[model samples]
Target chain A: MQNDTPELPIFPLILSHAMRPLPLWPLSAGLSRLAGHILHRHPGINNRIDYYQDHVFLLDITDLPLFLTLEPRKARLRAFRRSAVVPGHDAGISGPLAAFLAMLHGQEDGDTLFFSGALAIDGDTAAVLALRNALDDAELDLAAELAELLPPIAGLLRAGLPGMQHLTGLCLQRGSAASERAW
Target chain B: MELVCPAGTPAALRAAVDAGAHSVYCGFADATNARNFPGLNFSRAELEAAIDHAHARGAKVLVAINTFPTAGEEAIWHAALADAARLGADAIILADPGLLAHAAERHPGLRLHLSVQAAAANPDAINLYARHFGIRRVVLPRVLSVEEIAAINREIDIETEVFVFGGLCVMAEGRCALSSYATGQSPNMNGVCSPPDHVAYTSEGDDTVARLGGFAIHRTPRGAPAPYPTLCKGCFVSGERQGHVFEDAVSLDASRLIPALARAGVSALKIEGRQRSRAYVAQIVSAFRAVTDALAAGREPPALALARLAEGQAATTGAYAKRWR
Candidate 1:
């Protein structure tokens, strides 16, 4: 089988990274500030990606001009135009997603692309698919840029929790398993 | 006051019908049905026989074509609706808007019961279904409490059905993909979730771990009785927390809440397992039958009797309590 080994899913990878209660994972508000910083440093890669953990990001164009956030909570990248910052865990994001957004920020028009099948979208499929056609035109390899930009956050998390990269390191070591009643 | 129950096979159908179910619901053996599990549902011949058996016993039969129709390929679903209408079934449970439109136009008199998949929680959504497709009753999503159901009943003209037993999905019906994310198959698309075919129970040393799509959900001692790894009930590590983050190994049994549900204006009560054996079906249906009958006669209700059936799995009133919100 040519595509035999399913590419290690980036959706779960980023989610596992963001699963921390630490103040490092950038939320929506923090993402806006990060976006502003990127716009200043790498003006070429601004507002061309939308991030979601629902199923997958339905990027209609490889290079779009908006970053939509759909995980942990429902928020969008363009939301920063008004408030620019939000309270709570809005700013904390895993290093992987931050790297991906930075890649999409510098895309050109008419770039249609599809992510791997079933990207862990926790929301409605049709609603997200309906919004798929609205994508900005740009060209940047999200998967590649993520690797380059993730080193700092990775070091920080690894330092806080020793040997945190492997599967065994992510063991549920504390807290109520999950408030079963909260379901 | 009819009690519609799920039957995954002819034997279960007979069990439900024999157990004094006012009505029973099942599906054709294909993707057209929601409980499209392996070794479940009925063939065309089996469906006819099931309907014949139910009708002879004075119990009704409903055929469910509840999963959403795939884009650009709705012919399969449309034909299922037609075949169901032709088979003289009591009613057809439908969810997709396009499919409902198709059925309403083609089989105009074919009765339509809104599947819980429609998620018509609010009056506006319910009214939309009623006005456009003339939907008669809606199997309300498990997300609502009894008080909310009464409030909804007050505002809508349609009858309502509430789940009283079996598997529980924590998310709003039809608005989730946790299973499909881990395993490629999904309830809304392929009609199965965390599909049993993809599940593997492996012995890793002294521990037994339940794996769905190769991800570990829970690991217990090898001697422990491990449950199937359903996504909602699966254990996950989030920050420092681990355990059943979404739910536990419990199935829902709101048998205790039937009276409250009755008072809340629910016209019918539904049991969720279409995949159980004949004897299990008989026991549960019989118990609930007596409960509803007593409630109808204005007599004091009997104490609950399905504790052994609930087994080690805990039972909850589920979203009937708003703590889930």
Candidate 2:
């Protein structure tokens, strides 16, 4: 019989649409594809942020003043011991992970916040808390623009909402916070 | 079944004992304890008294030297173990492979119970620890199902203690990076997750922004109660989602599952949150004591008497129900 199936979409477009159904998806490939898109757009962040080994992001804590690494697939983290140059894409926080990062800068400026549940965390539960303390040496307030991301970029995230919700549910549900309003 | 309760200070040990804790766990006020907060935990002098106090009550004191020691500073951990033994602790809760090995050799008769930080999720790993380091009791990770727990119980000769109430750790210990990327220090070494000092909430226009370690974890209405910007529970913008990708802000309460856990043959019930008040600890210990007592007597737990103690006034059975991926 003659083949009549639709050919696979172009690699670039396919890469553009790649998404992990799991909430904590690996940032390596997704971030690489994101790098591809960023290279298509601004390109400078790729120069500032290195990305080679399994999606590592080095935050320019000196220039922008925050060093952060996120592993979406696993709900844990590894905090750098000191402020130094490391060869990895440092994910500079201009978004959600920002305020708590400021708390790591060492001021009791944060609010009456709740934890997801006493039990649920992504990667290393202890490491997550330690990383927060490591950043607790200074007071923080990210650049205003980075605090609330611009609408155009926000649209990109909103477009991928369902997949994000499903993945987050996978990551946190059995978590104490799963009983919270949104879960 | 045993009741493993928290004792942040020497005095808390007395309270936990007076409140009827079967065994109490406390940590050094340094990086050694998972509750490595300032002004919490016991000093060497305090430990001597606390151990003495628990001993007087005929209860056991399990020193929690659980956080992974710094790569080269294993000596700090070793000294803590020596001190615990010197002061007469009933057992030590350990997580690190090297430390467990060290304790097994250095303090052979100290009675070791593996910490949840060890993340022993299966029989093979549990057996490895048991065989390698002579671990007598294993605190199973929060990832196992009751059926899994029962199955592990059947195979392992040692006792198994699963976390029954208080905070739940959905992810394995020593594996996450969400906080470190934002701040620099994290739990595996620092013994905290989303440390309170790194948490901030700011008002911008109509939205409230919650940040942890310089990362904005959530954005809610200005007056709404913002959950702590814990990386896992915080809201984020990913692909098409703009909500908590890991979990929302809530605390774990597993009272309803006590009967199931008892059937699974668990040796003890662990309560999280050592930084909580003595009143909080006493309340939870008493409540669980009642539940376990009733479970021991083959009766049902009393109606929800400890509901208000949880963060966000919510609770879960966690993975003991076994639905997590």
Q: Highest DockQ among the candidates is held by which one?
A: 2
lDDT of 2 by residue, B207-306 (tens): 7576777788777664344454468777789999787578655556777887778788888888876755444565677788888788778787785544
- Superposed model 2: Cα runs more than 4 Å off: A1-183, B205-208, B220-224
lDDT of 1 by residue, B145-253 (tens): 9999999999999999999887777786755677777877766755546564566555578865667777888776643434435777777898999878887766678
How do all models score by TM-score? Answer: 0.62, 0.63
TM-score of each candidate's B chain against the true B chain: 0.95, 0.93
Q: What's the lDDT for residue B258 in model 1? A: 83
Model 2 chain B weakest 10-residue run by lDDT? B220-229
DockQ of each: 0.01, 0.02
Fill in the DockQ of model 2. 0.02
Model 1, which residues run further than 4 Å from truth?
A1-183
Recovered share of real interface contacts in candidate 1: 0.00
